[model samples]
Target: MPLIKNVIHRFHVKRPLTARERELRLDIRKPAGDAPHYQLSLIRLNSTFVECVDKWYAERGFGAMFGAAAFSAVAFGMWVLVTNIFKHWHPIGLFFLLVFPVLLAVTAYIFLCDAFTYTHYPIRFNRKNRQVYAFRPDGTVLKAPWDRVYWTILGHANPLGWLNVAGHVMDESGKTVLETFALSVNSTSKQGEVKLRNHFEFFRLYMQEGPAVALQRIQPVPLIMLPPIDRQKESWAFGWERITLTLNGSPLLQILAQVFFLPESLFRWIVMRTSKIPQWPQWVEDECRIEPDDPWRREPGYRDEEAIAAMQATAGARRNG
Candidate 1:
């Protein structure tokens, strides 16, 4: 029982996100007009770590269960057909019957292991320097130039497309520098496509033609506000409140609520297993230690108009000089 307890503790214990982390995860907005640095929004499938793991397990379990049911139905039909035709047992029929249980068990075990073992890391994009910062839970920080990184939207056709943006980084010689697990944005609605496209274009333009050109290009698009789709709560009452507020009057949620009724404890357990806490890289730490100017620090409430005006004035001054 102690061994089982240990396993449960490792896989089922939940870690709650601090307010700051919660804010960071949910705040999906474009860079402020005046801020010198812009932080790319962190995308995730679920709000809490445990919830992500739970969803992972739930999805795999559902797939496995469906596959087993389909297989069993086909096998049963074949058995009936063979018995009616031959009036005796056949080797093929027996084989199908024997394999069904084994297949179900194997699929269940595989999905269970997957649910408990997978971990996700946070990837941050800095628009100012065109840099990507990947934080490992083990306190290691990996950095690369934006040009070295590549990204793809996995489910572009899906209405909730922001959940599909995935990326990885490579070295100058075309060697893989770091392999990132698929990360998803919080928005699961069709509107996410616009947000995803805007963000991608924002960075790409800035990197390709500097900030001035990028700003001009992005100016026409209205500001995007991507609020949290999944809310993490400490209790069932809180969860209910969140559901009512966030998912109120949605027919999809009504259907989902009926199909997958997740209790609070199970949701927490899954999040605890899958979520990874990000740590600051050693270089960032060292730089802050040596100087007061921390490059990674975000300027709160920075405005884009101010930045654009400043850039234009600098250009005009240079031309006159």
Candidate 2:
């Protein structure tokens, strides 16, 4: 969890795209609903921006806590080893004591920061400004132009059939992969690529064509008002996913998974209690302010017909008036 998110900046911007990152086109202008499977990551989708957490690790708490604990345990063990060697004033222990603890401390800190510091690292796609804003773990936000970003469905070989659908910030010449932020990376099966395609198409359509047009074009999964999450409040479900358990849809496996969910849910609750909700910079919020009659805004769980009709009518009335 923290291992990946904390080091996301390592690749840096202005570098060339990797061969793995270059594959797959997420062109929604190509088709409509090949296989709709959204991970239900939309925190809020209004006139100004569409907000979502990392879909791959939506159920973030337990895994993140485990990661932090693992690092901490190893760090502590290394310190004990260093002390055992140094109590008698061994010269060799000097470097080991100083370096090992320092490295472990830094590792522990990163994981702790991930598990207890912030609730979630949200990626916001602002349609009004045509910009993408990613909230980093280190109290800063990365902003990039929407059109200039390389949007695609990335297939990974290590995770074996796993795919990541995300947007990349390329170098000035538009060839190198400078920065990477994702929509979702949870899809694992080969068929997950198709589901991810449909999922990516949801946002692609929303960003490119607006919610009204997107509502008309989407299918299979059927777009609806996903209950908006509290941006400033942390809850037990804070880092959870909408549809959990990739147990091949087997009832027995799902039941077994549920048996383990008890402990998982407890860890999730513990993580949020120690963590704080993320707060975007005031300037960013100011830019995100909505108009009183903003047509692009709609409540979660709103029907497609109503979504299309409501926003269109509002826009139409404004144009007419």
Candidates' lDDT values, in order? Answer: 0.40, 0.64
Candidate 2, position 209, lDDT: 76
Residues 152-247, candidate 2: write the lDDT tens digits. Answer: 766563455546677787777878787777775456667666777777777777778776766556543345545544444444553333323444
TM-score of each: 0.42, 0.71
- Model 1 RMSD, rounded to 1 decimal: 14.7
RMSD (CA, Å), each prediction: 14.7, 8.7
| Model 2 poorest 10 in a row by lDDT | 238-247
Query: What shift in Å separates residue 199 of candidate 1 from its native position after superposition?
Result: 4.8
